[model samples]
Target: MSGRFAELHLDQVQRAFGDTVALKGMDLTIKGGEFVALLGPSGCGKSTALNCLAGLLPLTGGRITLDGKRIDDLPPEKRGFGMVFQNYALFPHMSVRRNIGFGLSMRRTGKAELNRRVDEAVRLVQLEEHQHKFPAQLSGGQQQRVAIARAIVLEPPLVLMDEPLSNLDAALRLEMRTEIRRLHQSLGLTTVYVTHDQEEALALADRLVVLRLGEVQQVGSPEEVYAHPVNRYVAGFMGYRNMIPVTVGSQEGEHATVHTEAGVKLVGVKREELGSEAVAAVRPEDFAVVTEIGANTIEAVVEIVEYHGREQAVEARLRDGTQLHVRTNSRLAPGDTITLKVPAERVLVFA
Candidate 1:
């Protein structure tokens, strides 16, 4: 699909259902061949925005254009877009070959062209041996592969996926994420993937559009969104573990200096004076267990320990009754005392 990519613009697109507004004045621009992921918790309107983009849900206001032509008015079939749903949506009675060829049949393509495309899609999905098998006969991952093959077989300029891996097992989901990213990179097709799984979105998307309560919270590359979340809500969603409540003492340049509840003074992620009190968002991985305790060091009693393959999760409580989560490689017992070194540069302060 090289040179066939189309720039898509969603300008102030709004969708509402009477009392509940799903997407309110949403605007986004997708560059050609770029992969974008809409990420948020359930009921946050990420799926609603995606359904609107696919023409399954009509926008209550604003417009959608692709390559300078309005497309929100067009029906889904006429829009020439591919959709992959979470349930796979494969026909139980249809064989793998028949399911993948269903779109071409709807268009009444020539028999020769249909067979050629179906064969190519089957091979592309590594389902050559199961081409004659029915959906019931295949595994969940295999069925998902068929669904992906069906969507890409039509060679649409854009692809819309709504949590396509949610139904799979953990291992299968990990496997499919890599395959999907590879497929997207190879095709160079502009893909808009909707997923609530933060890890999945972080792994597969070139850019992320984070949504909350029918509004966009942030839009940027995964690293940008992960490193510099604008608010506490976005920070918590991005896996910030330490939310230290602090009072803003002063502001200068890009950061604001604040006083932590532990009577420690340090620079946090404060962008502006958020009243008198603000919360600092800190990643667990950023906290280091140090041998010496001094200024900016918090002493805590370890409550429990959870081991991850690459790192260890330590739960500790401060003397002032604040719970803290710290990630490190050291092994700690339940009654052990540990000191955490908090770096100001790695902290984000929010109102």
Candidate 2:
């Protein structure tokens, strides 16, 4: 699918169900061979956007173009895109081989071509040993592999995956994540994936489109979006567990010094236009237990501690009842006092 599906553009895309809108004016351009993930919480319209792109859902407004040709008006089969659903929507009675070749059979492809594609897809997914087994005989991961093989065997220019790994266990999900990335790279397929899992999105996508309440919040490369989120909502999704309300004491070019309600002063990199009121966003991993702290320090009492193998996840509370989560190597118990320090560069300030 190299140059066949070069570019896809979603221009002012909108989807609504009567009075309720699921997606609104979502604009995105995906180049060939790029992996883009639509990320947001439930009811955020990521799935709605994917359905719109796949022609499973009709557009209430705007248009979708593939290689400069409009396709929003086309039906699902007419658009010729492959979709792997979350439930691994395979026929229970069909064997792995039949499941993978279902699309070709429906298209009335030649027997010789169909067999060749099915065999290649089985090998591609490493499911050759189980080709004769039914879906009930296969594991969830294997069933998912069959679903993926079925989609790719058609050699669709674009692939749409709606949380394909959500049904698997953690270990299986991790393994399948690598497999999907390998398939995308080897086949050079343009992929649009939808997931609410930030870690999965960060691991699989070349770029991320973060949505909230049917609207796009931010779009950028994984590193850019992970390191620098545009707002508190995006920051929270990107692992910023602490959003401390503060009053800006001073503002420099791109940095600000703000005082928390507990009288803790923090210096953070500012990315938005701010007034006196602002929020300091910090990830749990960015906070460190320090003995000496002259700046960017918060003193709190530990409330709960969770052992996470490599490090301890501690929940602490400030004098004003604000809760802060900290990830540190030091062992601590409830009611213990600790000083947490955050580097200015690791902090993000938003209005």
Candidate 3:
């Protein structure tokens, strides 16, 4: 290992393409042994930021430092950082063992040392049985394992993964997510992962840096970010499928009563500085079917219902013709009228 990675800092890091900027000034400090995810949708600069950190793309301004020393100017190979690309990127003809040891071989590592490290890497990824198989011979999951093994075999203190699980199927993605977490803990690697999937970021990251249009939207622990998004855009990204326009009627401490554009009164926790107009963001799963008319309740007609095993995913239209997504266990079909109530704490109002 390259000694223990103490800390990494991106100070005012920016990337520009001629007149168009792909990443804005981003400042972040990542502690050793921490898993930080760069999360956002397509064209959100998550990948641009990761590439900048990896020395794949030169920064337009600012600098990156590791343990208080500048490393952003170093070439990727000289930085001694391991990288796992989105695609497996394994050599088609090379055997798994050879692929895992390619970096060591390129550095002219001693034969015995190379064998030992490759063997350990193979075991770490639990691919001992297929060590002799070429990339074409392995399954997608197995190929991904080989890719991971290849990177870790170098014993780089910091690992950068660019949507490493994006190519896998749903089941395989979940499986590899667990595997990646295990490897991070067992090896004590400082990981910077880039992904557009919010759930994956929440599941794997100790901290999340949400980006939008090249600018950082928020940075917080998964629990904090998921429970309390800072803005309407972030709320939408974090699975709040319903965004209702409202006019604030009254404010009481941290709660606000607002009249919806459709003239329905609803209460929600105030999350930001509000003007007369604000948005009420609610996660579909937060809506509950209520039997009585109460605070924060909405009367809507079910437009669509889809089975999601434990709950039914519903698309409903409010009296004012606003569509809302709700997740409920109630047995309901299209055209059925239902009253969905969201707890005040569950509804977030943002200006």
After superposition on all C-alphas, the RMSD of every candidate to the true structure, in Å, is: 1.7, 1.3, 1.1
**What local lDDT score does residue 241 receive in model 2, on the 0 to 100 scale?**
97
Candidate 1: stretches off by over 4 Å: 1-3
Clashes of 3: 0
Which candidate achieves the best lDDT against the true structure? 2
Q: Name the better of 1 and 2 by TM-score.
A: 2
Which rank order by lDDT, best down to worst? Answer: 2, 3, 1
TM-score of each: 0.96, 0.98, 0.98
Q: Write the per-residue lDDT of candidate 2 for residues 98-211, one digit (tens) a residue.
A: 999999999899999999999999999999999999999999999999999998888888899999999999999999999999998899888999999999999999999999
Model 3 quality (TM-score):
0.98
Give the alpha-carbon lDDT of every model: 0.89, 0.93, 0.92
lDDT by residue (1-351, candidate 1, tens digit) is 213645789999999999899888999999988999999999999999988988999899999998898999988888878889989899999999999999999989999999999999999999999999999999999999999999989988888999999999999999999999999988887899999988899999999999999999999999998888888888898999778787888887767888877766767656444888898788888889999987557788999899898789989987767788999988788889998888877878898
lDDT of 3 by residue, 43-117 (tens): 999999999988899999999999899998998888888889998789888999999999999889999999999
Model 2 score (lDDT): 0.93
